[model samples]
Target: MLPSQSNPNPWSESEPAEWSHYSDLETLIIEGAYSTKQPQAILDDYYIDFKQKRQISNIDSNKQRPIKRVQRKRDDKHLREERFMDLPVGTGRSFSGEYGWVSPFIIEVRRHLGLQPDQLPSKDPQLIPMLVEKAAQGIITEAIHIRKQREAEKLAEVLLEKKNKKMKEVWQCCAYLYTLESFLYKTINAAMRLIGDKDHEEVWRSKVGTLGPFCLLLWDDPYNTKVTIEKTLYRGANLKPEQIAAYEEMAKHKNEYRSFQAYTSCSRNRKKAE
Candidate 1:
């Protein structure tokens, strides 16, 4: 008869301690607060209260705190006594050569079998087949587990499909919420960009063709790709190793240098002519 198949429990025995602690902290902070009040505002109030209490305690403590004196001489003597004065005698050779070239494989096999490295019958060729058989059995067991896992996953997918079909309203609500969030995000981003562009234009007008600030503002403009600036800087002055490397990478696809071999060949020919 075939072995009885059982579904393994997917959930762990306990929720992670750190996650539980964080949830408790969140609950504590949000407890009794109006939903309209921001969490950050509440947290800031709590922080200020804590700091005021700490300042009061510091002001109240007039007397100097007691300082512990260290006995350096005694500590030094103790450390010296504890320290190793001499190294152990070195053996001429460490490893046994008896096992030959197969020693490493033997050690690895023994480790997988939960045996000590020296426990395997390294000299016996007959035991090799037994080891191979044991390894094959382990592989077969793992493969069976993997097959069962795939079956469980397929079953889960089918159940999920049915659940999703039943929760059409819930899915619609989620989609609506996501759409609203995305719309708000894009609106805010667009508003910020408009404000920034206006500010940059005002700054550029105030500067009125001033080289440094105008160049900086020009570079800061969203429309500018900065490729021209990068190339100009790369050619004109010494740059950082990272900047040089980036330029080299960008140079690869540029019209001037299509490939490393092309660049190298040109350089080599120039050098040969020189």
Candidate 2:
């Protein structure tokens, strides 16, 4: 049987650091859960106190400047209740489950019976490409499973175009493992001469693997990079005609963006990042 799913994960769902808000009730619950699961050593390493989160919240509230402003959202919620008291229509009728698609706890509690489960088996970064390959079993032919090579090419394209701090850090961390030889024999290779080639990719894969989606989720935070990639990067997959048409429709749809704050990742490439 497929893994049934984590019944009650310490993270609630594996929330990327970007979506974490200090005041969200769901955030409180998840963090509190992890506070229990977190190894004592990790807590000591981070200098977190070994106390109930309730007590920790009390201590931190004195220094927490953000808590002063969160009362306004509570007031707005009260106003919503007062102005439109018709239950689901005014409060709970969220066609989108509030902001639950990206973050958590935007839906009204009455409407939130159970949460959508996290689909990944676990959040391990090393197994990400394997997960994608398993998920893509029937979709494509054998030759195109070179996830790392494509990622390296994408990394190369980004480095050559910008050659800025973020890409520079990526190069420092990865160039030893991800070598693009198409430009190697002729002129001096500026993008750090690759030590390994496509022929020995398993060697590189064992070293660095693909920059898996979990890595992306962790490192893509602006707080970690101080800047993020704005240019479009493409990843191609074999798509049926109907799938292409469906994606074409999605491409035309406008998406609304919302900004929220608190917390972060560890990009080992840069000293200041995490």
Candidate 3:
């Protein structure tokens, strides 16, 4: 064999002597040459720590398994109170030969409160008193239920349904109340269009809690003499970024109405006057 075929860069005597100075130098050199793409010494230390931590964690998990299982089982068990309460009037097969038993009690309560089928409570001082009475009745019913008086079940069901329906009705009425307020204020605003009565607009602005002098942004200018205004229109202008996007969406329908051009002209005149 040629001399070139021999080991080109084999470890020399001095190199081996230098390596021998370190206790595990030979093992380090071998690992560095053929092991993972990490610093072998550091990696070995990390791996040892990782193995110890994993063993500890496995032991901890084994100890906690029964406790976790018990907790899960407890969560799965339904309460007896819930089972009985869930049987309210129309939910399933009528209990004690009655369907929608809540209707009678609801009617009685509504009659006593002097409310019609659609009539909601006025914004009067009596409203809070009525709600308090109803809540008191609910508490009394709960007490009766706790005593295991089966006869009180009918009354309880009725009261519950009435409470639910009353809540729904109150929400609906509040919506209409807001609409009424808007209509009244918007009407007042339209009347003050060219007369420069800032007080009317100020009243609305105050009610709505807006900063500085503000007025509803009119969609179709009611002050326009050229076109006959049909429906009074105003939109809240104190808008956030998200509301600005909504305004742009509604504005896309501007061309659909026949009075749009006349409305635009009137709006332009109002701005010019301002």
Candidate 4:
């Protein structure tokens, strides 16, 4: 005869299960459920807020509960298995096999999915070479697109550097022109003071017929230079008719050609202060 089993759990019928004993297990279970449910609740609240803010039509004012997707363990497994079974397999071939074909397009679908000939696991020999060729071409096309994007980024960087350099050069050119204008004014004034002071006869004699002390040379038909100087002077100095007339009178008494420097200097100084 088989031995009779003794009652091992003596307190099962006599006492209630202790709350402290089950506290940790219950807490863990509750925390897991809360974590999963919290996101759902948040989404629900957001939807409610959105609906409340939106204007409802009289034809569709009633609140309808969301239709949830039914949970099916078998369906999920079947879908996953189908996807795994559908992946393309490769035969043993050389790197540049007759099977390998290039894509007509630069960007194709296979490469986008990260598929490569070397990465395939199967060695099935029955499939047509054309299938592998097309797949390979697709992969290569995606790679080409990625490479082009990288190259474009590099080219953009080079162009940006060149543009910044050009901008800096322009700023420098403007600053140089401003400094040149200021220097020209000072030299003209110094030359004029010397010429007007008859007491300094020797100094006036040496410099009056020449360009100002700072100028390297002057040309008889310096047309472009003259236009630039005139424009600069007009913009720098606020010359009135009376002032222009007075300068013109002085030019008649002195060498007319030599008067250009003096006129420009005075005009620039007057305008600059204003």
TM-scores, each model vs. reference? 0.15, 0.18, 0.20, 0.19
Each model's lDDT: 0.26, 0.27, 0.27, 0.28
Tell me, what's the RMSD of every candidate? Answer: 32.1, 24.8, 30.9, 38.9
How far residue 42's Cα lies from its native spot in candidate 2, in Å, is: 42
TM-score of 1: 0.15
Report how far residue 134 has shifted in candidate 1, in Å.
0.9
lDDT of 4 at 207: 37
lDDT per residue for candidate 2 within 130-245, as digits (tens), equals 43332122111211343223223333333333222343343242332222222111111111011122343343233122222212222223334343456433222234565457
Two-way TM-score contest, 2 vs 3, winner: 3
Model 1 per-residue lDDT tens digits across residues 70-189: 222223322222221111112121111233333222233344445554443233333333433342233233324334222222222322333323223323322222122112212212
Query: Which window of 10 residues has the lowest lDDT sum in candidate 4?
Result: 91-100
Candidate 4's residue-wise lDDT over 1-274, tens digit each? Answer: 0011123432356653321111121222323434565322111112211222221222444532222212222333332232222111121110111111221111122233343533221222222132223322332333243342222222223223333233233223322322231222233334333433345435434432222211211111122223333344322233456545655665586533322212222234433323
- The alpha-carbon lDDT assigned to residue 145 of candidate 1 equals 34
Model 2 is weakest, by summed lDDT over 10 consecutive residues, at 184-193
What's the C-alpha lDDT at position 102 in model 4?
24
What lDDT score goes with residue 269 in model 1? 33
Q: Would you list the rank order by TM-score, best first?
A: 3, 4, 2, 1
Candidate number achieving the greatest TM-score relative to the actual structure: 3
